[model samples]
Target: MGQHEKVATSLADAVGEEIGASLAPVDAELERLYPGDPGTRQPVHTVYVPGDAFAADTVRSWGDRALDALDAHAPDAASFAAVLGLADDLAEPVYARVRAKLEREPVEDLRVDFEDGYGPRPDDEEDQAAARAARLLAEASARGTAPPYSGIRMKCMEAPVRARGIRTLDVFLTGLLASGGLPDGLVLTLPKVTYAEQVTAMARLLEAFERTHGLRPGRLGFEIQIETSQAILAADGTATVARMIQAAEGRATGLHYGTFDYSACLGVSAAHQASDHPAADHAKAVMQVAAAGTGVRVCDGSTNVLPVGPAAQVHAAWRLHYGLTRRALARAYYQGWDMHPGHLPTRYAAVFAFYREGFAQASARLARYANRAGGDVMDEPATAKALSGYLLRGLDCGALDTGEVARLTGLTRADLESFAVPRRGDLTASSG
Candidate 1:
């Protein structure tokens, strides 16, 4: 038999053996779990970085700084208005330096930090903390100064836990989503994701919130933070992560890399020196590999230490170098985080640089492959292999577009149907 026939037969036989006498039911389950044809095209290379603090003061200051920097360096009206009203002080020299950087750089994504305590907390401060977070979100929304694509990290995990009870997380997220008046494309960041159950619990809560608010079911989406050791060290770590992604199903937008938390879990010192250490890199690499072809964007955690020294020259040099490193990661198909307004220009610079390079390379390679296969070729076997590669690459670069991929690859739309693998739960009914 030919290779393709042999492979298909083997797979079929394996399934039959695994299910024993229930071949039909097993086939049905397999079909549900691995539905669709083989050649789906999805965009993969979008970048998302977190904004350090989204409180009124921080956002306002950030905006002002962005505007002043833009005015001095680029002097463009759009940039000026977009970044204006950040803070009270103009800091002309700082603005001038930032403007210089913006003149040449472009930003694609911005994540605004809503709540994360830096250090130390009292047991009695839970209620106050929640109220404080609520007020901050409210002010940020009302002020209209937050970034266009902002996100919020709720107070999900804190010592002495303020938002208590069984539905505490649900209540906290609901309050933030409802009373906070979040931006339209806002992403909710879930920190310390340990188990698939956590993701499912959160998903159910989101569904309930949508129903209560009269909003569409999938209107709210979340990005999981895989920072805990339990997440990385689980016996079925990869499977668990995949299950978490599948649990979110259509509601998860991306996966975030939490370096510090992850390091702490591994008993590594949570210090600046540990930001991109070998262990962190290996952990992030595993996450990236797991997220491939899943249509879920993955981002690297932020640098914990900020630049210090002669404000203008030192910050500028530090930022420029930092941007370069971020650019490298982006080029490798991993987006990262930025914690401050001053870091915005660098974030965008990295994004645009990475995309410019990625798109050019991908477009050229795809064109070459198309030519080699001959125009409009639709070899199912060949197409499946190529499409798998394309899906992984596209997801890596955030360039997945079904229509565009179909047209370019010369694959029938039907072939793209199998891109999303169905959940194992969806395929089987448990007797218990």
Candidate 2:
């Protein structure tokens, strides 16, 4: 034996057991609170249409309009690339995919907005609209014409509209029940959440709906619209978004930043009110940080700029929207709200270009990591996890073909996930 190697301390095995026992509750709590990302497909953009205007063909119409916009303005990869400053290497592939995406799955997520976009309707009028929304969405889903995710954004839980909001949601869900069943991709949004209590109320309402319908508990989850400053920070100066997640009782699926509303709430002038505004960034940063490891994604808000008018004007608007979408993606906010049909071209263009631009490097690094082969850029398990997620997201959004990803990395989707996700035991197991 080596000198000094045989030396022993006065430590006992019971001491180790004691520490483990003391941490048992905390381990359980952490696991319960942060189960990690669900590893499901997250849409890249959520398109909002006024509730009263949503129809069975709305999704298809949006796709056609986006294609038309591209045909009229861009006409080809070279022209589209000029608009967005897409690199020459990325132009053709991204342009082709953007068109294909618009044709196949134009709207990844669609929200029927009853909150601000559709405002101040009579009780009977709103009631009928809610039911009609459900009917239309159900019909679209049945006919395989609906977006992957479809839902409504109801009024907030404020005192003036709490009952009305509840009634609207009740009518919508009940209407879906009458029209066969809830769509598999159903999503609901509760807008203007300023308090954790409001999240709790929404959770309780969903629970009652489940009980009444004999649906599974937690079957429904909603996105929390972060439109007010109070929702980001509480009166006590703590992160209210974190508390809202806790109060949601595990039913919050996402936190969507309301660009204009949030900016206005912070007193940002209308001209300066944008998603990239410092005020908006702060709110979304708080939201993103709070949602980390909690399986709730944070979505960036949309730009009000519409790509319309003459060729030059449309090109300029496309530049802004494309730049904004690309900026949000780089910031790790993978999803955003798309406000217009014309926005779709740039939205997909940016997304496709983003992933396509990085495809080679990401693939090579993932391959190296998968093979445990040394590379210039050293990667740890955490970095590997991020790389896997990036590729997966790119694949999910039609930016990267599944076969291409597998060929480049020599890994299947399941194989990537094996490295991407961390199990509970991996978090606390003793390292030798």
The numbered model that scores best in lDDT is 2
lDDT of each: 0.51, 0.92
The sequence of per-residue lDDT tens digits that candidate 2 reaches over residues 72-145 is 99999999998889999999999999999988999999999888999989999999999999999988888888
Cand. 1 Cα-lDDT: 0.51
Clashing pairs in 2: none
Q: TM-score for each prediction?
A: 0.58, 0.96
Candidate 2 global lDDT: 0.92
Candidate 1 global TM-score:
0.58
